[model samples]
Target: MSEKVSLLTARIIDNRRVAPAHFLMTVRLPLSFATPFPGQFVMIRNDECDGPLLARPLSVYGFQRQQDHAVMDLLYRVVGQGTSLFSRMIPGEELCFFGPLGKGFSIPTGVKKVLLVAGGVGVAPLIFLLHKRLLPADGKGIMETIFYLGARTAELLTGLERLCGFCDLKICTDDGSRGYHGPVTGLLKHDIGGFDAGDTVIYACGPKPMVRAMGNLLQDAPFHCQVSLEERMACGLGACLGCAVAVRTGEGKTDYRRVCQDGPVFDLRDIVFASPAGP
Candidate 1:
């Protein structure tokens, strides 16, 4: 932590329901704080105490850094208490947060093609990546970016409207409410051929199962794939070690690594997804 952690006094800029079960909120961070990178998360507190137990970790959706002004956008789903509070925040209300925490998505320096995969709320972080890195310098980018977004319905898919300025986007909703009537991976399989395998990269963030599914889909592909891993977190820091993930090692073994510290973003090949036993 910095001696004086930049106390960003963020006000709820806009709170709107984008999907049946999803919401998007924009918060204006203090101008002094640095802009956050894609795949980075923020620890939000509904109240300044332990009552809420722990800060809810959320991916940074996108940010705007203007003359002495910084604003961060968040795409959240109301799945729990912390997020519920986030959904209810009024436009003028204030909230406390700590972040730009954890490592973020890595964009290849000379990559000629990029594929961004998003699942539900997982789309949050990718928005930041596309806006800052993929957009053209003079308002048009050098690389071709293809966005693959998946959801059950058109309403479940959020945030693509803004990305139209940067990439060629494709949508897939299971219920046939939007573009393609199938999983986003379906689009990847058909469209991925347009780019060179060696020169392309895939950055994904979403539910655990989807990440695993994506891993399976890209197993034989030559392109590099990185998936953002989500774990049940207590302390957004490494102190708790509650967010450990199993990683494959060079010795043909597996070891546990902290998700909060070692990564929130990881190379797809590094993770070992084991099946859970139960009913």
Candidate 2:
């Protein structure tokens, strides 16, 4: 860990529901803290201490650096006990957190465009990636980006309006509650052919099935692709083998990688998709 990655207490600036089941929690960090890159995560310790036992891991959604203090935001859903607990935290509450941990997405030095593929709350890290830095767009080194978001309903499209301001957005809701009436992956497949594969990159974060599905779809493609694997992680520093990903090694050999340390971000080619078409 670096000098900045300490277990620190943060003051909740705001915590509110942004969507049907999604919530946004913003905290003010110490003046010494640095903003986390996209896909990096924080371990939020429960206030009850022993009830939930371990802290919940959340990806950095957005952040802003101030003259003295910095503010970081976490966008999460009320999925289980850990997250359910976070949903109830109020402003002014002190939350213990340790983070800016884990590997993050990597954009090539020069790219024509970037396709951000998000599934529901997966929008969290991708948005952070966009806001954290700029990617080289053309030979002249400009940047261009677009988002392909998928959800079951419009209500599940968290942070859609905000993301639109940063780049072009194409939405797909299963029930046709939003922009397109098909899966988001369909949008990616439809538009990916427009750019020069060598000059384009795809950055994705979502459920395993979606990531797996994308992995399968792009396995034979020319574009460089990276996917952030989501897993139930314990001991974010990699002390325990709590979060492991199946990786392809040799001809048929398979290995496991710890998501908390080695990556939440990984090359799409290295992963062994559970489904031929992925998840």
Predicted structure with the largest lDDT when compared to the true one: 2
For each candidate in turn, the TM-score is: 0.91, 0.92
Q: Which predicted model would earn the best TM-score?
A: 2
List all candidate RMSDs to the true structure: 2.9, 3.4
Clashes of 2: 6
lDDT of model 2 at position 64? 86
lDDT of each: 0.80, 0.82
Model 2: per-residue lDDT, tens digit, 162-194? Answer: 576678888998899878887788778787668
**Which residue pairs clash in candidate 1?**
136-140, 136-141
At residue 236, candidate 2 shows an lDDT of 90
Q: 1-279 in candidate 1: lDDT tens per residue?
A: 122235455778898888776888888777777667778787777664344667778888888887867888888898977787778778988777777778877877768888899888888888788887778668676787888889888878888787776687888988888999988887777776677777888999888878888888878877788888888788877788898888897898788888876789999988888735311
Alpha-carbon lDDT of model 1: 0.80
